[model samples]
Target: MSEKRSFLLQKQNDAGKLNQSKLLKAEENARLLVTLQKKKKEVEQLRLQYKLLQAEQSAANKRIDALKQKLAEKARCKEAPRVHPINPPCLETDACLRQTAIAYLKARKQGNASALSRHFAPDCNYQYANNREVPNEMVMNNIRELWEKWPQRSYRLLKVAYRDNHVELIYIYKYADQRNHSIQGYAKEKWETNSAGQIIHWREELHPGTSPAESAGYRLVPLNIK
Candidate 1:
């Protein structure tokens, strides 16, 4: 009976030791879980802070870019050209037209008539969109009349293109009488050259795209330009 009791006590003690070890293991797992949870919260906070810092940096860069742009614009404005009382020939055209225009502009600047006036052939006629024909005499007369009426009247070439002497002009014209408005127009002049490379006969068509001739030409040319 004593031997059986001793064996039973030993088994009970071993079982108690096993249970105590299991309890200790469970407590260690709980501590590790708490540490993991704390680390997770710290990572989330760092991520949020990083995102906020990135957003602030981006905003600051955008603001800096805007300021730089404004400064560049101001610098450009300060370096802008000064237009004179008698507007010069700023036309960018072929050598022939450019030379002619420059001479005309210099004469006008010196309070003289344009040298181009003598080149106008009396037989030449200009056709309008209304199919009205105006003689060279009429056109020249109108130019002189307009010039006299508005002394400050002048034209400037905004752009130029020449493909085989078909010199095209995108121009801007303004008069003192029409201070609030300016004329924006395009001119395509066909070439007729003299032996000296002077333009003898220039058939000028103004505001071409609206004309029947331009429409016909565009149809023959390309889809991209039209």
Candidate 2:
């Protein structure tokens, strides 16, 4: 009977040890499952961050491309040749006439009275707006007075038309008076040049109704004159 009792106690102990081992295994598995879940969450967060970075990079690239296109369009407009409405077929003497006209404008802008006098004939007739015809000397005096009144001035030639010995110029005139009051205007000028390329007759009509925005669209061609 004692041997049987001993055998029964040993069986009971073995069964209890097996139950404890199963419980330890179950706890380990639970810990491993928790660790695997934590790793999975970190990977998902990393994926989300990578996707966000890619979206931002794509947006930046699009903005850069848009800016490049705008710059290219502006460059094209700047490089395009201007076409004048009154542009006609070229003449043999047109180049000389154009040069003289441009030189006269440059001298006027420089406020160089002596240089201006060289382009005019002795009997040159000058008229401004609705004013009466004035002698060349009187015109020079008037120009000097104008220079005194408006110390800062610029002329932007818009168009030039030539017919025979006559040349027409459309220009924008901008000036700031002694008090720093600014004024912008347009002038239409008709000039008759003698065979010696001297200005014999000049008529100018001024229009002060042009808006600044309207004048800004015109491009200025750089002139190199001595």
Candidate 3:
């Protein structure tokens, strides 16, 4: 009987140990679950913060782009330094017309006399203020004579007007050395271009007392200094 009671006691002790181990495992599982839930919450908060950062960065980029565009527009306005807008016959032909006119003037100032012919039509006519119409054959000679009289001649274009096939210019003419005389005058010129963009007709209207004579006594045109 005592042996049987001892065996019963050992079996009861084993059952109690098993029950205690099961309880410990259950407590550990609960602790792990709580920790996992907290970790998940932290992960979700981090994701939300990341989304907010992306949105803010996008807005900043848009603002930078807008500022850059504004600066570019200001730069464009500063670069254009024209006093008056030039209206060409056709938008597509504006550049060519202006380029040709500039090149012609540059050639004349540089004393490239032979280059002048290429800018004019075959049957060009030049009329002076005295109603003297110089024929095509005498154009180069007249130009050479004018250049010889005032070797230091220069022109400042004051105003320019343009039409479909015509251009009118007002200019201030200056010759620093005409027998030690500083001569200046105003002149108006009109140019008529052919369909091929070659100058076919030209007219000159020099202000009174502006014409120079070859003689030493008439080295300067008599006019008020003003």
Candidate 4:
């Protein structure tokens, strides 16, 4: 009977050991599950933070685009030509029309083709001396060529006449080359303005005896001032 009792005690001890191992394994599994859940929470938070960052970046880009558009508008406004407040439209009165003509001459004297072209209509007719009517582009090209030939030149207004939309400008045009060869002559320019005050027709006639070295009584002093 004592031997049987001893065997039973050994079996009971083995069962207790098995039960202990199973409990330890279960605890270890619970710990692993908790760690996995923590890692998942961290990954979710990171994803949410990434989404927020993307949204902020998108908003910033929109703001940047808006600022760029505003800057472009400001630049355009600055570049546009200024209009007189008193005369909202161009060429309202005879005085205003005369001013426009003078402005054209000033732009020509300054050798600013862009400014000069602003005074003309898109399909303006141009004639020089007895030449046939040509497009304004040819006239612009001629002006540029003239400027190249005579870098120093001046057009002094003598008188102005107006008839309806037509304006007659009497001026003394003097020009000199780099070699000091100069010429001066009286010229007449007839300009017709459209309702918009832009020159739609232009004709110029230089009087006789205006050729180089033929201008009467005009003298070029020596460059040496000593």
User: Listing every candidate in turn, what is its Cα RMSD in Å to the true structure after a full C-alpha superposition?
Assistant: 18.9, 16.5, 19.6, 16.6
Estimate, for each residue in 1-226, the C-alpha lDDT of model 3 and write its tens digit: 9999999999999999999999999999999999999999999999999999999999999999999999999999899796542334453444455456566666667778768777767666677424444555567667777777777767665544566567665567776556856677877667787767767788767774553222222112112111
Give the C-alpha miss distance for residue 18 in model 2, angstroms.
Answer: 99
Estimate TM-scores for all models. 0.36, 0.50, 0.46, 0.48
Q: Superposing every Cα of model 1 onto the true structure, what RMSD results? A: 18.9
Which residue pairs in candidate 1 collide?
none
Q: Identify the runs in model 4 with alpha carbons over 4 angstroms from their true place.
A: 1-92, 128-134, 208-226
Cα-based lDDT at residue 64, candidate 3? 100
Q: What would the per-residue lDDT of candidate 1 be over residues 157-192, giving only the tens digit for each residue?
A: 444344432333344444554354434345454433
Better of 2 and 3 by lDDT: 2
lDDT of 4 by residue, 127-193 (tens): 7524555666777887899999998888876555565566666677888999999888888777777
Predicted candidate 4, C-alpha RMSD: 16.6
User: Candidate 1: worst 10 consecutive residues by lDDT?
Assistant: 217-226
lDDT agreement of model 4 with the native: 0.73
Candidate 2 clashing pairs, residues 3+ apart or interchain: none
Give candidate 4's error at residue 153 in angstroms. Answer: 0.8
The best candidate by TM-score is 2
Off by over 4 Å in 2: 1-91, 128-134, 210-226
- What TM-score does model 4 achieve against the real structure? 0.48
lDDT for residue 72 in candidate 3, whole number 0-100: 99
How many pairs of residues collide in model 2?
Answer: 0
